[model samples]
Each structure stands twice: as C-alpha cells, then as structure tokens.
Target: MTSDSRTLQIPEHQQDGAAQKSCYQKLSDEHVEELELYRKNGLHPVHLGDVLNNRYEVLHKLGHGTSATVWLCFDTQTSAWKAIKIIGASHSSDDRPELKFQLQLSRSDLVALPTDHFWLVGPNGRHVCLVMPPLGPSVSSKHQTMDLEALREVSMQAADGLAYMHRKGICHGDFRTGNLLFRLDSARINDLSKGDMLALIGEVTKIVVETDFGEEPGSISPRYLVHSLNTDIFADFITCQIAVIGLSLAFEITKPPKTSSVDLPYASPQLLLRLPPSTHSDVWALGCTLLEMQTGSVFGTAPFEIMQSMELLLGPLPKPLQRTWSRVYPEEMLHPEGNTEYLTWRSDVISEIKKHTRNADCLLKELAMSRKQSLKGLLAADDKNKPGSIVWQVPEKQVTQIGDLIKQTLSYDLHTRHTADAVVQHVWFDQARIHRKPRV
Candidate 1:
C-alpha cells in the first residue's frame, strides 16, 4: 500500500521512481529513479519543490521531520495556499507495504479531528496537509513583558485548546513552538508601533522558494504580511493558536521519559510514565511555559534534575508531565534530595526572585491595574471561611502547577500519568482569575 501503489489510488504518473525501489510492488520505475537522483545528488525528497500533486502546485517546502516532509502548496482550483505533508516510503524503517499500512492508520487518525480543530488534519481523499490558518508572529512573554493578567489569558486559551485535544483522545506527540500558528493583526504593546509588530510577524511566517526541475529557480521570498494589532475575532483566533503551540512545545525532550515513551520537559508525573495524557499534563507544561515567558529561557537540564528536585521537595513529578517525560527518558528517573533538599531549593528560587524584584509587588500592582486584573483572583481566595483560605489554596495550585510541570516534563517514569487533559484541569486552571480589562 505504498503511496505509489494502485491500492492507495495515487496516480501512476505522480509516483516517483524512488517509491518503486522499495519492497512494495506498487511503486513505479519513475519513483525509483527519483530516489536515485536524490541519492546521487545528496538531495532529500524534501528538496524537490514545486512538484505537481494533482491540481495543487507545490510552491515550496515547509519543514522536514524524521518521518515526513511538508510543503506549502497552492491549490489551482481554489487558488489557496495549503500545506501538504508527504510521507515517503523510504522514510520508514518498516517495509514499504507495512509502512503504507501504518500510514493508512495514521491518516485515519489525522482526519478524526474536528473541522474547527486547530491542530493538523487531512481532508478526505486528500493527502494529509494538517491544514491550519496561516501563522502570525508570536507574543513572546519575555519580549512583550506581559502583565500577570495577560499571561493568565494566554494560559486559559492554551488550556482550552489542549483540553479539546485530550477530549478527542488524541495526543500531540511532537508539540513545539514551530508547530504553533496564529492570526495576524495590529496590536499595540505599550508604545510599540503596529508596523514594528508586523515586521516581526514577517520573520516567523513559513518561507517559500520556487524551483525549476528540482534546481534552484530563484531566491526565497516572504509569503505575506500579517498585521499584529488588528482587534477582532480573527485576532483571538491567532492568539488561541499561539497558546496551543506554547503548551505543546514547553519542555520538549530529545528522549522518551521511559523506554516506551517520550518525556516532554515540564510534563506531569503521569505523562512521564507513558500514561495517557490528561489535563494535568497540559497544566504542567503551561506552568513551564509561564516560567519561560517570565525567565526568557528554557529551564531544566534532564529528567533526573527535575525529578530529583521535585521528589525531594514534594513527591513524584505531577502525573501530567510524568506521562510525557516517561516517553523521552524511560530509564527510571528519581529525585535526589529528600524533603529538606526539595524545600530548600524551592525556597531559594522563590526567595531569589523576590529579592531581586522586591517580591514582584510592583509588577503585580501594575498587572492588577492593567487588562489582566482578573488574574489577581488566582493569587487571592474565593472565601476566607471553610477549612482553608484561598491564599493557602493558591500556593497549592501554583506549586502543583510548577511541580507537575517539572515532574511530567523532567521525570523518569514512563507510565501511569496524566497528560494535556489533566494539566488543563489542574488547580492552576481552576484558580486563575479572568478579568474583563486591566488598566494600563
């Protein structure tokens, strides 16, 4: 069932010689020749740009991963730009026939998502493109110096998206910043000019370069200009997309949390252990994202570092981060320090920040007066009665948020954990304040 095979219904003319060279009998000689040409020239299948795919004119290559190459193509019928990800037979370790079967399975999963789902998906009969609205510039927490309220909104929107994925029982296995796309509009941050923001957007939109006969036809060019300050539903759409990408990419891992799964940095304990992703996992990652947004750097070294720290301070990494981390570093990670070590380390980091920023009181005050005033609710309590007050509970949510993030993303467990779903519903999500507007 190679892409070139009759079983797949791919036209013979479109089949490449390289595809034929595989064990699958479906590949044509032409497919094999293409593979040979690529092998001879050290050109990857990804390098072949502007090839025709039925009615679509492939304009340029988007990005390449270990298993597939995505292209930004132009649909001749609708005259629209689309992303087409072509998974080649040679890319898989399995036999071409087996690979085809797996692709069929994956393709089915690809289409299972809802039409409004911002994540990737393929339409019926069409090869998987994972069509998404064009991406715009990202709102870097570090770059923009967001108030607490703005940060909370970003987190909430991200939670909503991740929760949606978990509800569908789909895991975004390879979440990253590059995968996130947003709407482009005019936004004024403080005194920053709208034109300045648009210029930044221009830098991030996927680039396209045309070619002739697999040869360099010309230089690369920008696809379009995205305004950053436009206020409308479109703007919210873009913001939501970025929020999704932000959650997915947090604490990306190079290895699985355990031998059987991949562990995302900042994943909850459950996620690190190869457990099904849940809201907890999403929360853990969001905490890390917020930290990154605040610190302007990727935190943590390896699973052991975070796991050891979290274990000493509290216990196992949160279920969410654990699930994702388990997939990356499956070798049984544990916290090194006991309770004292954990407590000391936690206190040190917080105290250090407070010392430098004067308890972040000024910042919080400004945030309370800004558009993010709703977020203060996260720090305050709903009621002073009952067993415990909101202040005490707020710390729990914050701790769980941070701990789960560290555990899920940096732990060694590979099973029995939460995922994006759990993270979304964590105390952190339930606690964050949502204000109408904060005074600037």
Candidate 2:
C-alpha cells in the first residue's frame, strides 16, 4: 500500500479553497511522536483508551523510540499491567533477530522478554506487538542527586544482568544506561485498581492534532497525542532488580551481527573502528555505562572527542589502533594549525576530562558528607565536643575498587577487558546492600 493511502485525507473545505490555510493550529513536536511518521509503514496510531486484540486496553504511553512506541496497557483477561511495544510496520516479525534471541532467553529474569506477541493490522500496516511486564523508566532518566546506595544498587544490578546475558551466550550489542530499566514492584502495581493507578500516575496530558482546514486526524494519527506516563510515583517501589532491555542490536556469540548501530558515547573502540561486534565490545560499553552512572554524564559527545577522552583516561590507544586513528582522522583535522600555542583540541580534551573528574569528585564529597552526618547523629555528639570526629575521614577504598573494575572493563586491548561475569563478581558490587526497601 502507498503512504498516501494511510495519510489523513485533506478536508473538502481546503480542497475547494473555501478555508484559510492559516486557520489551523500547528502542533509542537515536543512531548509527542512526529505527526509525519503516521503513514503506510510507520507507527501505528494508538490512543489511550483503545483496546488491542480485544484484550489489552491502552492506559498510558510508557515511552517511544525511532522504531516502536511502548504503551502501558491493562490486560482484561489476565487483569495485569503490561507494556505493549508496537513495532513499526516497516519491520517484519519473522525477520527480526531481536525476536529470535528474546524468545531463546524468555525465562531470564535479568532481561525483559516478550511475555506474548501478536499482530495488529492498522491503517498504517500490519505491525508486530510485543506484550511485556511493565517496567519503570530507564536509569539514565533518574535524578542526578540519587544516593550512593541507590547508585550502587543500579550498578550491581546492571552488572548482574549483563553477566546473566553473557552466560547465556547472548551479546547485548548496545549496553548502556538508556537500555537498562528499573524493575517496578509487580505485585503492588498489578493489585492497583484502574482508578487508583490513574490517581497515582496523575492525569495524562494530550494535545489535539490540528491540520489544515481543521481536518480530522482520521486513522493516520492518534486523535489526541498523549505525553508519556509520569513514573515518578513508582520511585519508592522501584527495586534493585534491573532488566537489560532493547535487544534489537543483540546477537549470539556464534553468529556476530554484520551491522551494529550502537550510540557513539557508549560504543566500544572495536565498534567505532568498524570491527564486527562481539561480547568484548559489550564489556567496553558496560564500563562506559558504569562510569556514566557514577559521574552523571557521558565521557564525550562525539566519536573523535570520545576517542580522545578514552586515550587520556584509559591510557593511549593500542599501537595498531593509533595508526588506524591517524589514518581515519588526519593530524591536520585534529590539530588544525601547526602552532602549539592555539591547540584547541588539546585544550578541549583537558577541559572535558576536568569537567567529568569534578563531577565524580562532587559525588564523592557528597558521600563523605553523608557518612559524617550519619556518624554524628549516631554518636549524638557536637562537632566541637567530638575529638574522634577530628580524625574521622570516609575511606576511599570503595572508590579505588570501583575505579579498578571500570579500568578493567575499559581496557585498551579487547582481550584485556573484564568479562561480564568478572565484573559482577568485582569487590565493588559486594558493597551493594540488596534490599527492596524504599529509597530514603
């Protein structure tokens, strides 16, 4: 079917030139999916109250990505909350390697697998709909002021999840904070009545899609676009059980993926160098993820910039890779001018490193202050009266252990990188007190 067949038909008033073009309300792209994408092989138009397969009732939009839109749905038959991911019609269910791998490891608690699957024939086209247990927002979306204990919990859970996947011979080609979702309290969430759930999540914000001549959106787009569900209410119920998600780039160890589309900031040197993806590359990405979680920022924004940061932080690139880097990015491009006095690249690299280091230091300082305050409260002593407080200093042993672990995973040589299993068993993770209690 042609894209035109799926698009909303222009109103007769506009066709006859009776209505003014300027009368229509133009919708902002913010907080909503692109209206232009609702076509023949694009996103399936899903409304809040719509029911799919005569069972799952769409409650709110959980999130969306380039290829699919995830909705928080209530399954009438099972009376359970589910996150239904509706893949774009352009992608075929049978051809998706993600589906194959997820099905293989469906029983894994560390990974978010589809509990059920079905096809939805919409105005756009037939799309693959995956039913999964609803999960909270990604770790990357969490507040930067997250406590050290919570951070440790996230780190340990993520490492454990990755280790599980690696043990199953699956390589999560794109391993990053964005792909790690915090597990919600299923029993608590499921037990909530529809009205109670709505009250907790707050009202859904929606905007009417206005077109030229005030044309109805028709079947192409949703009648009203819904803002993604606010999951802040579930923050207290968020568990340490993190699940590794987004398996579209995942591949098996025996059959390496021919093509990879990892985000540049999280991508390993092997991937950036155009080498085939392997489990080693996943480890490199994991290192970057752990560092991001600890520091509240990525190492760099661009590929060349990240490579430069990698060199400074993880030591110089391997000899062969250094030669390849020179070939890829010539000296003239990196240095620009022969004069060392105005070396912007070097200055920029130094600035970036200092910025991240300062962020890490700030987090460490916060942790130390928290510890000091806790001790003061426990001892019930004033700062001036306490002689032991003068000499008391928070130990940096955990910092050193975590640094060693990250260094091992972010090793220059892929062979020298820590395996996923080793990362989980690291000394740093031992400090993580695994508990489901609410964050203080």
Which number leads on TM-score? 2
In candidate 2, what are the lDDT values of residues 324-376, reduced to their tens digit?
66566665555436434222235564465555542334444554554456545
TM per candidate comes to 0.44, 0.79
lDDT of 1 by residue, 4-112 (tens): 2112122232233333223222324221212222221122333223444454454434444434444545556655444554443333222222222223323222111
Clashing pairs in 2: none
Rate residue 377 of model 1 by lDDT. Answer: 44
Weakest lDDT window of 10 consecutive positions for candidate 1: 218-227
| Highest-lDDT candidate | 2
